[model samples]
Target: MKKLLAMLLVICSTASAEIQPEPIGRIQTLPDPYPPHWIVAVDVAFFHMNDGKLIVLDADSDDPAGRFKGMMNGTFIPVMYMAETRPEIYVLESFRARGHRGERTDVMTIYDKTTLAPIDEVVIPAKRVSAMPTEYYLQLVDDEKLALIYNFTPATTVSVVDLEKREFLGEVPIPGCSLIYPLAGRAFASLCGDGKLLTIQLDRNGKLVSSERTEAFFDADNDPLMEKPAIIDGIAYFPTFLGNVFPVDLSGSAPVIGESWSLVEGVEGGWRPGGIVLAQGDASGRLYVLMHPDGHDGTHKDPGSEVWVFDPQTKQRVDRIELALPAITMGLTNDDDPLLVTTNINLEVDVYNANSGEHLRTIGNFGQETVFLFHSDR
Candidate 1:
């Protein structure tokens, strides 16, 4: 009887040891030939307020690899990828505290690019502009040494954070100006409400070195310039609501406003440059703009039916790419086979060959309204 009980115990132990439990999820190593281009799409949810997400897509394979979805206070949170020293991403967004309508806390969260794991977060004290997408609201300066965050708590200001040290330095007050365009050296330029360009020079510690404002440059009320400017070689080309291109030279100590040029000379009537990302400049010094026909007084926010490529140096139209669908926003990749991506009215990203202007493919359903398409290489 003792020998039988011992044999049964041994058999049970051996069987239990052989039947090892498998891991819940296995980590598989990826093969070679990874996707080349990466596309970052921001899904701005108006109905489900807390369901906004920053989705990352592989352009070559057209697959969504990773995404970050959370409660955000506003509609215009921005994400920036830092690919210099390490693979990391920075997102400037706000979160609700106790309740949905409770106190808001603004933060800059850093995430690992590979694993999509959060690394660190720095709290920002100032309230950011939440209504519209401000292009330069959060801009990196001095080769990622400092991070400039634009704030608008009924007053315009910029909060400078030392990215290298991972600390918030302080806020620089630009009373009447908004937006930030990093100039040469440790300075930045802002567009003022009074139709002037405000240039502010900041030291390493986020202190103001010097500040100056240019004379009233353009008419702000009737023909206000678009927020996103195509900056090339220290020159910012701003497109107005009336299809006028305004160039400002920021290479020197101050901003030098150049003569304004028209973008619609030979085109028929009721045509104007309009869209979220209306204008973008390429590496070859060519400018791409979205144009729409039958534009009215407040039609600057309308979707564009065509894309017009122009040589800003010669101020002449080079190529016109007609779109199958009206685009509200557009972006371009910096690869050899550059792709011109446009977000249509149905929130689908229509890809096209930038050189030949041939339609490639449409990538996205995203499960929400995608407002912007930012290329990693661009």
Candidate 2:
């Protein structure tokens, strides 16, 4: 009896030992250079603004495990720009002295793509805009050597940062203008409150060289253009509160405001372009705009039901893409053959064939409220 009891104990011990512990202190690294379809989804976390996030994932991957590559957290409302020439990701973010609020602090964090770890940080003015996420709020110019940050301390200004030196270049004041659009060589154009395009040029040393404003291009109070614009081949395609396309040719040293065209010229059901990130222009200069029905007052920021494609040469919509779900924001992956990515009302990232407009795959359980999508071909 004693021998049998001892043997039972030995058997139980052997079984317990076979269960291996999870590997500890293991670090995983993503692909050095990610695939073309990989996108960084921005989670502004509206309900919980301080704890924001930027999720990087493979838009084309079917498996969820394979799709999610990496992520980084933000202290406050933040905007990110992926560097083309450098292996770094720039995040213009803010922090509070305490947990939620105290003294405010803003900084541009330089993160390494491989480790997804913040490698460097540059202190900037604490007056960064604290509203919805927009790529225009933060832009990279001067061959990615200088980053322009749009500030709305109620007073509009652009904070220039020397990317190579990692220092804060002087802030250029544009009294009534906001948003930043990279224009011809070392220059940026901003949309003004009085319906003008303010172009601010920078010297080789990242200093203000010259600035000018074009005549009133669009009606600001009546039918304002969405701050979001699809800049393709040196031209920005801005969609108005209605369904008009306002093109600003940034190909030259100064902006040339082109003629406007109605997108819903012959359409019905009150169709209009609306959403957070509603516009996208591909390498071929084709415009992809998010559209919906039953447009009304204050519905300019509503989610979209379809994507209207347009031919720049003809200034006419060529194709209309019906979405599987209502999308709040949209973006395009920069591949030889691009893919249109959109965030549905449920915060699921939907992938579609840019050319065919076919629903490829939908990525659910991505993030809590993805407000923006970032993907680049270059």
TM-score for each model = 0.86, 0.91
Candidate 1: list runs displaced more than 4 Å: 1-36, 62-76, 79-85
lDDT winner: 2
Q: Estimate every model's Cα lDDT from 0 to 1.
A: 0.75, 0.86
**What does the lDDT read for residue 256 in candidate 1?**
85
| Candidate 1 residue lDDT tens string, 1-378 | 999999999999999889677889764322122134555566555455455666655555544333222221222355444445556567777777654667788877776655555678788884777755645777776767888888888888998888877788889999899998877667889999889999999998999999899999899998998878877777888999989999998776667899999999877877898887788777677788999998889899899999999898899999999997999988777566677888888888787887789987777655547556464533
For model 2, state the Cα shift of residue 11 in Å: 18
* Residue 50 local lDDT, model 2: 82
Give residue 36's error in model 2 in angstroms.
0.5
Number of the top candidate by TM-score? Answer: 2
Candidate 2 versus the native: TM-score?
Answer: 0.91
Shift in Å, residue 5, candidate 2: 31
Q: How close is candidate 1 to the true structure, as a TM-score?
A: 0.86
- The parts of candidate 2 lying over 4 Å away from their true place are 1-25
